[model samples]
Target: SGALTRVKTRFYHSGVLSHCVRVLSLSPSRLRGIWASAATLAHLTSSCCVGAEPGSRSEAFHRLFLPSVVDVLLSLAGQLMSRSEAPPLLRTVMDAVGWLLSAHPHLTAQVLSSAHYEQIQMSDDVTRSETHHTTSCLPEDFLSQLNDESALLLLNDAVAQLALSSDAAVGGASIRLMSDSQRSFDVSAGLDSLLEKDWRGRGFEQEVDQLIAMPRPFRLSRRRRRSHS
Candidate 1:
């Protein structure tokens, strides 16, 4: 009775809860008290359910929340893939992936690519910060997390699209927009230096040594400067 009431209430509201629940169902995490509610939502997203459309209110809400949800799902897929566990959850996760690719084809590539690189970059940062006693200039892992393969493809295609549309300036403009935040990404620049060194083919043994020898840049705040005098 209470469960059906919850489902009915969600039906009149948002679709995100339902989709997330579908994810949780396949998840090994054993979420408590919400499974029934989630199943109710998934029931609605099904083909037999009424009123699902690309530009409808429900779809808008899906777009708003779905990206973040997909990020979680991608992370789940990576974890499952890593562990070689192709359970029922994999099918559900694949369903979510298909939905993402179909509904947001333009964004799908970028999102996945960003997720992959973000994970690698974050693990690298954690190792660097803890082991080397360094401060990272990167924002919390969320900002650069958008650099995934799908997003990169979308970006590259977008560049092509811009050229096709005869708007080459858009690509340069995007780069300019990023340069607006240059100071904050200096650590990324430092990492770029290290990576490029390895690509030159003679620095295998000395890559880490060179990285270790590099100076960490210090940022001077106005308040710190004021305190000194």
Candidate 2:
């Protein structure tokens, strides 16, 4: 059943590969989503690229997915100039992509040929250390607050229900609360409590309702330094 195992491994690799791409797409912008996906990407990447049997499985990915990996990461590297600590997963994700790219004799020109190449080239490139001084900043807990998918989902549903409430009085109050809360997300305190109850084991919607009951409940947002900047 090794062949069958390899088939399943390839299938697994394909899905994880897609996840890394999505994270890259959202990076330096969707910092929280980047937060959510970083640990997941690292785990999945280690399993697929580093832990897998080295011969056929690796070769298949190198031939099929490596070029796409290079192109996508080229995009991510380009975007980091403006978003400080924007991607907590940048190192892990890049290691995975870097490992795959290393197997090649040389890097590919696929990015040069891709439509995003020009824009990527023109973007102000940034190093991680240089990212901190750029006037933009991410909340220190950006990764801790969004460490998992269920948490992100709950936050999204919480925002949606608050912003789009159907009850006239409650909707008005919720929107007003959201308007004030949108200035910053202090829900980091509530997140641990929110995530403590297993929405996966119980009802996710039920938990959303519970979260809706909390006063001053807020939407997840990137912090903008509007005061001095």
Candidate 3:
């Protein structure tokens, strides 16, 4: 009886769904298997219905895929965050987070709102650990350019863009570094000094003089009256 067999399969799937929810809810570590199972199911279902006509069943299958896909993406994000070599792979992870965010708002909100704070804090701890092991870590070229104020401004701008645009993959340590850099902003000190040197007798000087010659808004009323005859 084809109808009887279909009814049995439906009951089996329903039972599996209940078990999956229980596992996902109770144990955080249990999430690793969730992605594997969800992926397998999606693959199987997609293959089975490839030739089936478009109808209610296809719509239901797609609706079910949404939550399962979100779960897998979120779990993967958390797993990557815990890895030791995050820096070397940071760009790759950021791209993944951006991709996930575009497709899954619920997952994006969960990561961006609550999970990101802890993720960043842990990354800061890792960076600090690395710094303690080395006396002088930066390259010689970086050290040489460090004294040039313009170079520092350029470096700050580059890091700032990475911090603002990067998603879950960028982690907390990278963001903390950016924040620390922002707090240390001193245009008068580093790159600012270089800009001042280059701009000494250039158009910058002429622009400054022009600005000085310009009347203040308060003086505009008097200038208007004088010009009116």
* Deviation of model 3 at 172, angstroms: 15
Q: Write the per-residue lDDT of candidate 1 for residues 157-221, one digit (tens) a residue.
A: 32232222222233233232232221222233343343344222432335334433444442222
**10 residues in a row with least lDDT, candidate 1:** 128-137
lDDT of 1: 0.38
Ranking by lDDT: 2, 1, 3
What stretches of model 2 exceed 4 Å from their correct place?
1-14, 26-36, 39-47, 50-60, 86-94, 106-229
What lDDT score goes with residue 79 in model 2? 51
lDDT at 67, model 1? 55
Model 1, residue 115: C-alpha shift (Å): 2.5
Q: Write the per-residue lDDT of candidate 2 for residues 1-229, one digit (tens) a residue.
A: 5775576466555576556656655645465545435445543543354334435566666666556556665555455434565454444444444344333423323432344434432333334222111111223222243323423332333343333333333323323333322233445454434334422233244444545454543333333334324
lDDT of 3 by residue, 1-229 (tens): 5565465346334554334334434333654545444333433332322222324454543355434433533344345455555433332333333343333333333433334323443455343233211111222233232333433443343333233432322222232332223223322223223324332354344433432333344223333545765
The models' CA-based lDDT, in order, is 0.38, 0.42, 0.36
RMSD of each: 15.2, 17.7, 17.1
Q: Deviation in angstroms for 57 in model 2?
A: 8.0
Q: What is the Cα-based TM-score of model 2?
A: 0.34
Quickly count the clashes in candidate 1: 10
| Candidate 1 structure, TM-score to reference | 0.33
Which regions of candidate 1 are displaced past 4 Å? Answer: 1-51, 54-63, 82-84, 87-92, 116-229
